[model samples]
Target: MEQKVFIKYFSGTMSRGTRGIVFLLAIALLAICAQNTQARVTLENGVKSKVYLSPKIALHQGSVANKYYYDMEFPKGHIAIKSFNAEVVDEEGNPVSLKETYLHHWVAARYYQRKGIKEPKHYGNLGFQQSDHIPAGNAGVCNSASGLSQFFGLGSETRKTSTHVPDPYGIEVGNPLEIPSGYEEKWLLNVHAIDTRGVVDAMGCTECRCSLYNVTVDEYGQPFKPNYAGGLYCCYDETQCKVKNGLESVKRNVYMKYTVTWVDWSESIIPVKIYIFDVTDSWQYTGIHDCLIEFDVEQSTTNECMDTRRSKSSFPIAGDVVYGVAHLHSGGIGSALYGEDGRVICSSRAIYGEGNEAGDESGYIVGMTTCYPKPGSIKIANGEVLTLESNYSSQKSHIGVMGLFYILVAESSTTLGSPVQIHQESKVPIFFWGVAAFGLAIFAAIVVAYRRRRQNGDGYHSIAT
Candidate 1:
């Protein structure tokens, strides 16, 4: 566009080149007029769904850089923006405001499992039934994240949909290395973030931070970080965080080894927890330990960063293989592995992202899924604090859904003004008249008659680019 202006302006000054300059101006005017005829939808900055309180919503972010990648900073009341290409019409056939609206995204979802617990009843019908009362596999169902897929949905307070897109960086995992004494090697992770139609606000964004610990190098490709996020919050502090530019830095130098707590063990039980939603009937998560499963680790490494094996992988007591699930929260994006001992292991770097909102809008994207020594030998621990985080740049709070709308507007028009306010509807008639006049000018310059799109409605019927 700038080059075109230069040509039109400079060439017009010369006498002999005046005709060519006029021709270029005429072409530009026709293009301008043609766009005005089709221009309609206007994308805004920030527009997203609100935080759902009832029934709870869960957000899971794992691994900021490597598989354990996690490096996102989120504040309360942050909005998300998503863009699409379409027109929205209301029930009365009226176009609602296209500007993006500010929305908040948060996570709090409930899991329902059935556990059988014999409560003190009037008739004394309380007993552990293995052959008759409860069903099979009731003893192995401790995790229920996949079951909550039905209740997944985002909401909007107003009757408007987003038409803006923010730059998003995606991560993919690859290749595993296993060693007996220690593990060492650099792994590869790929990332791609698309540019938004508007200027993206990536404030307070740090590189994806991750840590690898409680590692076990028991089997090839089967190495597990028993505890996700380097044994939860125990081995982590503010000082452990490192920042760099771009997403690839998130996955470098990711490995762990430890000898502390020589054995790793975990269990998850849906012990009969009754919710008195009603008087006669009650809702429960598990049917009396029906979802009870546990996994145990026998060997692990003790060396922190340099060692790839968790010292605990060599569990002292040769504990039985107990399998249960660990959490993959929204803000935290990464993978977990079980050490040869009974400990948990995680990546060394955190997952970093640049967006208006974190995983709330994306809704707890999956981090990692690996098979332990035995597929069903792992178990989730009891009374664990919910630590899933969608950590991102502090910009998430300020950008809001309005920012996405702004991006959409940018994508819609090359000349979209700084303070993007769409042309008024009534002025559209005058806009069309001007377009026709410009088209006639182009026709004169090019020595060709311009066909009226309103009458022909044929080719070249495109909206503003």
Candidate 2:
């Protein structure tokens, strides 16, 4: 009997030990899983896409066109835009008029600097230097990302009905317009609006250069300030500038949708910087169109439209230029880019809508064509000035308008990393592991409690006998 009892006891002890071993193994696995979950995130290779839009702005009487900037927010890391699209719509998702109504232009860009530095310097007002005056209330945001000047002419110069880009991204597949670290985590979006109502030649007056006004009287003849600083009108006569008080009221909203496709880089890569130079930088706005120089087609007179080179400014750029393009409006003949010593670099010509088409309306001047240079073909050295010779027709009277906007794209030469990339990479791993460790500890505690209960049950059974 004792031998049988001894055997039974031995078997029970072995079974308990085995059960303990199995439980311990499970706990260890749970611990590892918990640790891994806490340590790193499981990632999948794919593209990330999102949509953003500007605030809906109302267009009222005497409003011709308006311009404003929107700062786009994005995650940190190397951000490359694979696809981009912009359009105007009503509340019902229907398209607005392409002839009279337009999203004149929308520019997408980040900040750029030539000299390498540990931290980015506050870019003074976008369109001004340190000595320039900033509107009293506007001084706080003058030259920073929130300031309008840095991205002044960085986007489309003329009106765009719409833009849709398909896969195999330009620059490189999976590669996008990178927003470098240390720079603002925002993309500047410039928006323009136009409305041509109550004008006699809203459609067919071949010669019309609209005059934009600020703080104009509304259709009710009451003075009102628009959402933006100015508005566009097909003003042939100075008398048309006055608000027609009894005219039928018209209201429209400027709506925009921007789609950005990007790749979440496994590791951060060098970013691409965008540089913009507007010919207006050299010319001042006098509010009179005819007084400025012109390229006369009728009298066969042309003006040598020369301005100080952009390189003459403190704007610094290093490294090879990957892509370059120009923005021109109606009456623009073409633009010539020049390096130091008057050597012509490249010329981007304008293509007008000859016959009456949808975008190429009969009377109105339509869009300007853009150009792209071969990768690495154009290189601007530090302190080098680039002169933009812009050509516009003297045959038609055009508003004191823009000439060529030379946009150059290059790799970041600055040392500061994108804050987005640093934040994303540093925190994710720590968070994952921390959570996993907590889970493993909880699981271990449960196992220990169960074992204690089993031992108590055995003792209770022995006493009950």
Candidate 3:
């Protein structure tokens, strides 16, 4: 009835040309509204983002807080994670400088707990080896026994590093089909931070030097080998590093502020398997994938002062590498991964900061370059041997240094061609084109109506003259 009323008024009072222009304008308006609705739906279907803070950590001058919290708050339900970024923050939500509190590392791992079982209060350094808890670690390369099985992790470089999983690909988690019966999925967060304020040797503390920490035993109360000097074993929870004399100890609280971006799981989202390669892996000779988490680089006697380490491991399965990044300590120069045929798969270099701010603390590694190769451009054949090389400066002795390469691989069976792929490849959104078309239609209608009116006025003026 409203349409009839609008047509009756326009048909009686408007010229045919004006009526046609009005109809075009109305159609354009409807098109814009439809586009707006579709854009909202697209965002709803695409990705969701949220920021969360972990439980508060208490620390005094030169103290270390390396605690693991089970069942941390994470996005619940089945989803494909696109990215995870984190940083240290004080109580007022302000960014904390790395110069003050050194973020040794933060690791996020997945696990499954029995439906009716309650987890224990203490989860000692042994990890989730209990019967009721099942650790769901990364895809492979490092054995679970090595404790480098986290799905996501970073140290001081966490602030500037890019962990985004590109379009059509994501780190899949929490799928109902993958969960065992009577067990539910949960996330575990391990934050290892060192309070370096007023410390005698800031660099030594961050490097976990045993002399500065004054410890001759590991976290498990086991005696350290004679050659073991500095590493994670020396700076376990509650351990203290050397602090300046007469500096009153002041306690403060801090938290790990992290942001997570993910999308609801769907058939179109291709799953990527995470593989972390360590330069210290001794799988070739030992016939066991024993990965020494950290190693020291002694100062060279010769002039070169460059320590180079390499390891070779076979790819478990054939797949396309979607993303790659390297994890290196402060003294690391750079690292790279080479295929069996000597092709460079990825090379990541540590980015050192030169400022005194939080993310740009001078002399600290703020970030590492990342790799997002074109889909299918970098492929790993089944059982292909790959070489990893990590370089560090040996001008000064460095302890607890690590060289880890993290990569995301998608199986060959997952096709890259999809409707989502086209959308992702486009630099601009479809709704923007719709908006431009709508604006053009309005402008065209106004010009057409103005010319018609001008023509009618000219005809009347000629008659009057």
Ranking by TM-score: 3, 2, 1
User: lDDT per residue, candidate 1, 1-465, as tens digits?
Assistant: 997985564444333544566667767766775675444322223222121111111111121211111111111121122211112222333332212111111111111113343322221111213321221111111223211111111112111222222222001111122111222111111111111111121111111112322223321325435442222121111112222324232221111110000001111111111110010011132222121111112222342212111101111121222221122222223323334342552221222222234221222221222222231233223321111111222211211110000000111112212332222334234456676776565445434222332324465553558
Mark the 10 consecutive residues where model 2 has the least summed lDDT.
Answer: 133-142
What lDDT score belongs to each candidate, Candidate 1 first? Answer: 0.23, 0.44, 0.87
TM-score of 3: 0.81
Residue-level lDDT tens digits of model 2 in 187-208:
4455555455554443221222
Q: On residues 1-465, what C-alpha lDDT tens digit does candidate 3 reach at each position?
A: 997985465465556776687678768777777865543323334576677889899999999999898888788888889899999999999999999999999999998898898765774453676778898899889888888889899999999999999988989998999998989998899999999999999999999999999999888889999888899999999999999999998999999988888877778888999999999999887867789979999999999999999999988999999999999998999999999999999999999999998899999999999999999999999999999999999999899999999999999988886744322333345577767776676556556556656878788432354
lDDT of 3: 0.87
Q: Worst 10-residue stretch by lDDT in candidate 1?
A: 400-409
Off by more than 4 A, model 2: 1-47, 64-78, 82-85, 107-190, 201-247, 266-270, 282-315, 341-344, 354-358, 362-368, 411-465
